[model samples]
Target: MNPELLIAFLASTAGAATPLIMASMGELVTERSGVLNLGIEGMMLVGAVVGFAVTLGTGQITLGLLAAMLAGLGMALIFAFLVLTLQTNQVATGLALTLFGIGLSAFLGRGLVGQTVDPLPHLHFPLLSDIPFVGPLLFRFDSMVYASLLLVAAIAWMLARSRLGLMIRAVGESPDSAHAIGFHVIGLRYGTVMFGGAMAGLGGAYLSLALTPMWVEGMTAGRGWIALAQVVFATWKPRGVMLGAYLFGGVTVLQFHGQGFGLAVPSEFLSMLPYLATIVVLVIICRNPQTILLNKPMSLGQNFRAD
Candidate 1:
């Protein structure tokens, strides 16, 4: 393969994977806190639309990103209230949240279709970016890519070594025990769910503000679900999440450039490559029940009532 082609492939792969890294990391923490929020797709859609609309109107990317996070935060709050406060079924509520996000975003973005905005600028280092191969590969990405990686490192370290991480893991493992031991299980779960929503929103915002710089209804194209799958693919580990995201990202980028590489595969099959790869990886992972069982959060998707 040509060096230039390899550089482009690697760069695009990192771009494609950035959103998954953000959203999956958020969901990773949420699941670790024993709450299952399936509204990520919905949240991403809302974030995408809101971010685009706001950026288009106000000409401020930062505000748009912040608004997107708040929008997602609001959605998570609703979910938290229903499942945590009212003790509603986690799965049902999550499904409802997704549906609501879809409908709400569609309504909000109705007048904003066919619009586009300037993409987030990629950071350029003066001398380093002028370097031959390493420059384009390492220094040309936007800030979000590096931020996502940093978030992963932070979460991994926290989970492995922080007191707060211990509480979150405890809540996921046994809410009753966590509650009995004087930890506020409900409060902690609320925080994690909200954090997940914000991250999902930020991921969505990235789609509009940086990746494609445009809005389309359901623009996320099931990436939210893929992010959820990635959490499991990584066995709930942050570093593993990064690896899984990049793997999926690589597959996604490949489909776009597959024909360019002289592959004779059908375009339709090429389009299906990312999703198909997801299913295949999931099936292979599920075949080993112990892999899931050992790392699975005990109280995930379960509602807890305080005694």
Candidate 2:
């Protein structure tokens, strides 16, 4: 293969992986706080439709992105109310949320079929993007790619250095202990969950508004579920999530290339690469529950009672 072709391949892999990276990182935060949100798929779907619809109406990609975040946060708040306030089963509530999001998006997006929007424009740095093989591979990408990198760096800084990050970790490890230390456990959980939802929503929006630039039912496929698996694959670490996202992204990009290379594989099987990679990574990580338990939020799926 040509060197330029390899660079392009890697670039496509990163582009494909960006959404997963965003969604998985968000879920990592949520799970770190001891909340397992299974409705991620639903949240992403809602964000996709809502973001695309808003962009179509307003012709502002920024507004569309904001709308997508808000939509996702709205859905997350509903989950928070049910599981946190009403004390419902976390898993069941999450599944219900996913169902609700899917139904709502399908109903609302009927008119958006076959429509298109101007996706975010790619940013090319002077001289940097013009470099021979590395330019196309590294420098030419939309703002979302940079945002994903920034998110990873920001998350690492927060978790490793920031006071608020410590508090979040405390909340996840043991809400009771965190409460004793005067941390607003409920507030922290709610905030993190909402943030996670927004990220997931942005990830979804990236697909509809940026990647494909069109609306389709079940467009997210199982990316949300894959994102959930990524949290586990990362062992609840921010950098781990980034690596896992790229790994999955590579699988995604390779599937398309596999067909081009005429590997004689079924398209369905090729498409399963990302999900299959997710499962394999999950199994490997879960093999050491003790290590996972150490980093996992102590109260992560347990409801808190003010008593």
Q: Candidate 2: list runs displaced more than 4 Å.
A: none
Tens-digit lDDT string for candidate 2 (37-78): 999999999999999999999999999999999999999999
Best model number under lDDT: 1
Q: For each candidate, what is the lDDT?
A: 0.92, 0.89
Q: TM-score for each prediction?
A: 0.98, 0.97
Task: For residue 17, give model 2's deviation from the true position in Å.
Answer: 1.0
What is the C-alpha lDDT profile of model 1 across 1-307, one tens digit per residue? 7788889989999999999999999999999999999999999999889989999999999989999999889899999999999999988998999999999999999998888999999999999988999999899999999999999999998887999999999999999999989999999999999999999999999999999998889889999999999999999999989999999999888887887677898888877888998899999999999997777899999889997
Could you tell me how far off, in angstroms, the CA of residue 216 lies in candidate 2 after the best superposition? 0.8
Instruction: Say which candidate scores most in TM-score.
Output: 1
Clashes of 1: 0
